[model samples]
Target chain A: MSIKLTYFDLRGRAEVIRYLLKYGGIEFQDVRITIVPWGNLKSTVPFGQLPIYEEHGKVSNQTIAITRYLAKKIKLAGNNNWEDLELDALVDTTSDLLEKVVNFYHERDTERREQLKRMVLAETIPFYLSRFEAIAEKNFGFLAFGRLTWADFFFTTTIDMLDAMTGMNVLKNYPHLQGVVSNVTDLAVIKEWREKDKSSVVLANDAK
Target chain B: MSIKLTYFDLRGRAEVIRYLLKYGGIEFQDVRITIVPWGNLKSTVPFGQLPIYEEHGKVSNQTIAITRYLAKKIKLAGNNNWEDLELDALVDTTSDLLEKVVNFYHERDTERREQLKRMVLAETIPFYLSRFEAIAEKNFGFLAFGRLTWADFFFTTTIDMLDAMTGMNVLKNYPHLQGVVSNVTDLAVIKEWREKDKSSVVLANDAK
Candidate 1:
């Protein structure tokens, strides 16, 4: 299969896709663009964005959509349509959290960034993490299912980025969430994937 | 059949779900909540957000997931998994556009809001709209498919929201997008749905 994934070598949005691919043992090109050529490369990509997926010569963009495609290909998606909907809803909930954390991370102004950091740490993180912890608790250490789904991969990879941004273990008090994380990262394939490449797995700040 | 959709009486995020239900010819309890009770109702809803769809007893949040669920029921989703992925990627592209516009619309500071407006108008809107126009032109008046799909419904509904927020006809120069909008709005069921309920079809600003 001529499958190729293209993005900055950052663990920001593309991390979950990478995790899913590694977990599935899918083989394809992992294209990592550095900072210098991005400007020239940006216009050439679809929708002027990173993280485009190419399969059989047809390329597509959008992180979540691409993630779903790979997840389905790897048989990590929900068993039925209704199950897929549940997983999609769960991914979006984590996306809501990721969006907030990303905004804080991307903020350039020092004063405003500090203000956002406070709101995120004080209110936003607890609000979503508490809900997520409860859901993981109910799902038996998974995010939205009894077994590992793409939602687990999504949140597990995302929490690493979130923890990196905050400079602390954000899931310190949420054992279920921490369990979810461990369940994902401790998988043999995932551990092997991480050990395989340390360069392309850099976080957002380090990617810059 | 217990189908219920609860949201503020606004076209902000829930409009596409409303459109899908109308197009599906499905009878649903359209519960329009007013602003006064939102605070109390916020914590009660999953994800603390509006536009929650309750079917039988399963209550779910996240607008896109709900849209896909209703679309599948209505036979508006893609015919296959690959087709669904195509439609999903298209929806996510529009979502990228929507996120930028919503942030611009929701900014409380007047000066920063204006700055966002300029960037949105001069750069972001064109960046997305031109690409959308080309895709529509290729698809012969549809957004992502040769025939009407949920992506069309998504973009058509979202363009209305974007146009209202920008206070201008953003698609004036893009004939294909304009045609896509007209095609969706002129649908017999959608037209009837809107005509029957004017109170709940308000846009984001007026809903406040």
Candidate 2:
């Protein structure tokens, strides 16, 4: 049975999974849900939240979990015990950083947002991106493994999100990370998907 | 070679992994970092953060990743495909809820904190914990599989954390969730661990 991907129309959290499926050449049903008329669909969601994934009719919520599930299905998880762990770590760190961008809206006019972003730019993003870069440098410039894992894709997604949110380009400071993000976006299938439905994927607020 | 668990002595984020290690009966070198000597130890932490796991000299960060690594090592990740994926989803959801708690602190004002906590208590926590309860009810009353997965432990950990923070017990409204938390804590190993470290584990500020 084809997996059912449920989320809103916008390419927010669910887009990464969609991109993963497209990039991996996997077939699945895309179920787009919007805020309107959620009354009927409310009960069906795992936690009354959208962006759920159903495989063989067993549903799962939590976007990152759905992403990991897709990655696992596509064999995009890293090889070996250590590499797989690194993949999870890298993806999670990326998730945390992206969430900070989300929180920036709620934390406006407060020093907390700037404090948080400063921490991210100063320590968090640089730390993970640099570490991934080192791994890439050691292994022919791939993020986690010698090949592209979900970690690389996740890192690319974060850079895209951050760069879009903040006018300042996040990757300019990290050259190796720039290379990694460039490589992922330059993937043939991904490039095709991005261009094919550019309007659908692009967000108005993401005015880079 | 012994695995090295790097984190501060405080059981802030690393407690779950420590609990899992003790519960699983694995011994590791707990490398407590001291900040009083910040200049010395700052360079060692991968992301200028705590709770890094080093195995065979290779290092990693991200709390969820560390927990998953340990859980996989101890065979606590569950055996079947559905169980494993479900567990991952559950853990990710729990992590999302915890992030809300962190946001509560950053919000500053009592009014903002209350608003955030109410939103969390009303929408986020119940939405997650309730569905998790249903999943647990359907699958042996744990978060996933026939056995306790990292999701179960993470759920229990978050329950303890939320309950302590709000002075409102997680079990008060959600009976099934309370049951799951109880079931996990009642496990022989978890029970013993809690009994031995009651004072330290019970934070005073938990009761809002």
Candidate 3:
């Protein structure tokens, strides 16, 4: 099957899907659109959104949806229906955190943005991360079911983007979250992919 | 298995789960908490959020997570992985519409709220509904795979809430979307449940 993943060149929503593909040793075309060309390309896609995955010419949008599909294919999904529910819940919760962080990034007012950033760094991150840490602690450094699931991958990838955007060390105090990041990146495939993909470095430079 | 669904008395997020259970012939406890008592019960839940589904003794949070779980159990999920991806994408798209409507409802400034509501009714609704209409038109009035899936159910239930919250007739121009709503509510179980559930009447009144 010819597979292609399309999104902006930035390491935004598409990063998790890319990580999943790489970690699973799945081969796919990575189509990245620059901001200048996104306008011309936006309406051509389903729902006028990016991070779309096309397999055999059939396209699907929505970040988590794509991730979930790839996760299931790569055996990153849970063992049962209930376990999948737990994974979904955790993934959505982490997405909520990312949404708040994105809002802070997009806020135009400097003072308000700073205040929002402070709140995100202080209250919001801890509120969600502490709970995630607890879950990972129980699940042996994995986010769900005591093993690798897409939730861990989702959390690790998006949290890295959050850290890049905010210039904040999010996992400094949360050992289990740090463990999740390490566990995902420690995979041989992911480690090799990171060596070749400079998207993280680009994101860090953009934040600066 | 004993099932209990807890959320606010309003049909905001929990209504989808309620509809799924009723449609699937599954029995569950409908635990509705009013705003007054919510403060006392907030921290007791898993993530301090509502629309939690509890089976036997274990509890899970996140509205879509709960809905997706029930969908799988009741055969409302897609027949295969690719079809499931389509369902997830469509469900998430409808959710994006609901989120914007929610923002309008929560906006404090009258002028700003009016502007947001206008955008929601005009650009936002059409942008999403038109695409959905096209999808439904192709799939025999169903949102995904030409049959009843949870995406159809999610769109049906949440679109009603959006209509209620915004006091707008979202599906007036989209015959296919109207067909989806009718298809879901036309189910014997849902029809019977709606007759007894005063929440719909309450929402109708609120829209007035």
Candidate 4:
């Protein structure tokens, strides 16, 4: 099936799907649009949003939905129904953290942005990271089960994005999260893709 | 398995899960905590969030995650992997609408609240509802596939909540969405539950 992912040039929402497709050895056209043209392009898409996945000419939006679809196809989803539920919960939790960090990134007001940054760095990040750290510790470094699931991929990508946005190694204090990052990035396909993908490479360098 | 759902007395986030469990003939303890005592109960829960579903002593949070778990157990999810993806995408879209409406409901500033309410009523509601109405029309009155799935249940309960919050019959202009509500409420199990559940009855009355 011909697949094409359309989103902005940044790794904002489509990064995890890109990583999952690469890790699963799937090939697709990565169409990155810039901000200037997004206005013209917005009305044509479903939900008028980005990171849309078009498979066999059928388009679908929503980042989590697209990611879950690809994850299930790649066997990155859990083994059974219950396991999938667990993985879904973790992915949603990671999304909660992502929203907070993204809000901090996009805030225009200097005072409010500082307040958001402080909340994220002090309360939000630690609150979520500590829970995730405990979960990873229990599951042998994977986020959901004892094996790699889509939640790990989602967490890994979000952590990279968070670090890039905040210019802080947010995972440095959380060893379990660090392990998750290493576990996901250590995949051969992801490493290869990161090396070649300009957006991922730039994000990696920015985080460092 | 013994099931217990803990949330505030209101149907803010847990209502969809409640509706799904009821529709599935799954009996659960509806544990409602008011705001006054929530401060004391906050730190004990995972992520310190509401609508935590406890099953046989295991606890899980994230409303969509919990609802999806129960929906699968009751055979309310889609028939196949692709269908599940469609359902997930629809659920996420409904969640997007829920966020906007809830923002308007909770806004304290009168001028800001008025602006948010206008946006929700004018742009957000129509944007999402028109898409959903078209989908329902194509699916023979159901949301995702041509059968009753969890997305339908989620959409039904959320529409009810939106109506209650906005004090408007949100489904009035969208006949397809109204058809969806009728299709779900026509289920014998849901009808029986609504008749007996005071919270559901109150919401229905408020919407009326």
Model 2's i-RMS, to one decimal, reads 2.2
Sorted into a CAPRI-style docking class, model 4 comes out as: medium
State in Å the error of residue B139, model 4: 1.9
Give the TM-score between model 2's chain B and the true chain B: 0.83
Q: What local lDDT does model 4 show for residue B112?
A: 72
List residue ranges in candidate 2 displaced over 4 A: A106-139, A200-208, B33-35, B38-40, B202-208
Best by TM-score: 1
Cα deviation of A8, candidate 4, in Å: 1.3
Give the per-residue lDDT of model 1 (tens digit) for A85-167: 89999998898898998888887778989999999999999999999898999999998767988899999888877888888
Q: What TM-score does the A-chain of candidate 4 achieve?
A: 0.93
Model 1 TM-score on a 0 to 1 scale: 0.96
Estimate, for each residue in B1-208, the C-alpha lDDT of model 2 and write its tens digit: 4777877655667778878898789877877655576557767666566778877778888888889888888888857656667788778778777777666644558887889888877877777667767777776666666566787788888777777666677667666676677777888888887777543333344342
At residue A11, what lDDT does model 1 achieve?
68
Using DockQ as the measure, name the better of candidate 3 and candidate 4. 3
The digit string of per-residue lDDT tens for model 2 on A67-185 reads: 77678778888667677788887788777778766666345556877876677668766766676567667766567656877877777766666766555687676677777777888
Give the range where candidate 3 chain A is weakest over 10 consecutive residues by summed lDDT: A199-208
Clashes of 1: 0
Q: What CAPRI-style quality would you assign to candidate 1?
A: medium
Off by over 4 Å in 1: A200-208, B200-208
DockQ of 2: 0.62
Clashes of 4: 0
